[model samples]
Target: MSSSLRNRLAAVVMAVAAGLLGCTPASEPGASSEPAKPHRVLNTTAQPEDTIRVRGDHTERLQAFLRLRYGDKAALDAPWKDAWEDTEVEALRPVTRRVCARDTATADGQEQTLLAVCQTLDDAATVEPGRVDLYVLRVGTDEEKTNRGGFFAQLPADDPLLVMAQRLQGQYGRHGSPGTVQIAQLGPQRRAFQISHEEHRRGHRRVWRSYIAEHNHRLRDVARYRDHLDNLALHGCDGNPADCGEGVFAVDFNTTVGDSNAVEGYWPLTVRASGHDCTGPATAFYHLIFDARQRAYPVPDDLQRDGCADS
Candidate 1:
């Protein structure tokens, strides 16, 4: 077997073992306030004494990328220390998914490899749980140039994707439940990314925001909707306890994205809900059409809100 394959298999095994052993870091009472002592950080660059060097492998590159990004944060030291490079904590490690790879002709008409990668940082504790980041790597023949330009370059401040991410971060506080990143193919040559944020209050709620890829590697907001909502509090059961079961109302919608046959330069989102309420079992379907001028898929006003109202 190839060395790369073996390394990947070993990483999978280690992640599984770590999960089984429950080595995830816990939020200490005072760990966030105090700065942790300096420790050896993973070295991605080639050095005389370094044992392993990160080259083109995405997994290795992601590990090195995260260590360089968050290794120095004093607040994250405790949980970061237990991550893959330092110790064993699956939740604290970086999770990566390859979006796509394409060979395109450059200005000089030479074929260049472009790769899109999505990485989620599940800090477990300290702060920013399930924070996701996207990267576009331009692979070249020169290792030094590729590493310097692709791995270390930061996303521009005005980038649409970064802006949307920041908005979500502000909407959901640091201690909010971990969010998830997903990729969907809208058409043969078109693709989009969906960011889902879940929160729990008296009830549970999940919202999905979709962005479509455009020219110059930018993303445009396409759709936003609530896919899950549940209210655990019983209502409309004042007289008798038997009706309490029917008083509970919860809604879950399954969303699917596909190429839009009706609209040009857009995609269609289908939301199907199979839920129950005091009224009885309820089912509904929403075919959200994209508004080109508005550049968004308008969801029903009722579905846009969270939680079930007491009737």
Candidate 2:
């Protein structure tokens, strides 16, 4: 399928999940606070590095881990902060709290192999901004379960992901059940529930699109990646090969965390990862992050470009 179509489909799936689970009405358009200048904030003093493993390939294991944490909704939208070499803090909001796992393990029939060093974030902590404790794991399915036995503890009450999910669920409940959230059906291939999810996902994308369109800006030209480990690999760990360079970074355009009156709300970024050299197109797990952060930071000069076209 085309990239746009795939994104649209992903959105539909997320909306259905939201309606079923009754998530909040997603974040308000101008709810995000102003962009915070790039400052090194400790993730969380309490958070420590840890790891977990799942029984599957890298893709399945990662997807399952994401589903467990973010629910099916996150697959529709990917969230993160954008910054430049000279960014100044105008506003800051915790977009997601991720714990990087190293040397994790996962089962693959007769043998256990290290698939990926997993990073698991409490779905509840993603909403706040700051350094969060992270762990690296040798890939394995039982590692997370085993590690959490005594080490797991409570997180802050206002963690961004926790708060956002709570609020979203409340909204979804208030709106009625997932079955009640409906959208115009497109055809035999598309269902009402699917359409609704797509709409919610698009709600955020529309915000980003509008922001860029209004400002005559485009993602490849205006944004920069935070250079986290996952981001580095996802964006192609310096190789920047043509086939491995497609990526989309979505940000919220508002100022407050949950403010109900922001303008031109969502920000969906589409970056062609191929700029680094000959990397191919990169991909995001979500179609639209039904509820995610919106960052306002500048892009690095060396990374700016027009489209995801071949360099």
Candidates' RMSD to native: 14.7, 24.1
Per-residue CA lDDT of candidate 1, range 220-279, in tens?
566666766555533433333234575566666788776557454456878887766435
Top candidate, metric lDDT: 1
lDDT of candidates 1 onward, in order: 0.45, 0.27
In candidate 1, how many Å is residue 122 off? 8.4
Q: Any idea what lDDT model 1 has? A: 0.45
**Against the hidden reference, what TM-scores do the models get?**
0.48, 0.18
lDDT digits (tens) for residues 136-213 of candidate 2: 122323333335452222321111111000001101111111111222111221111110111122211111111111
Best by TM-score: 1
Candidate 2 achieves a global lDDT of 0.27
Displacement of the residue 267 alpha carbon in candidate 1, Å: 2.4
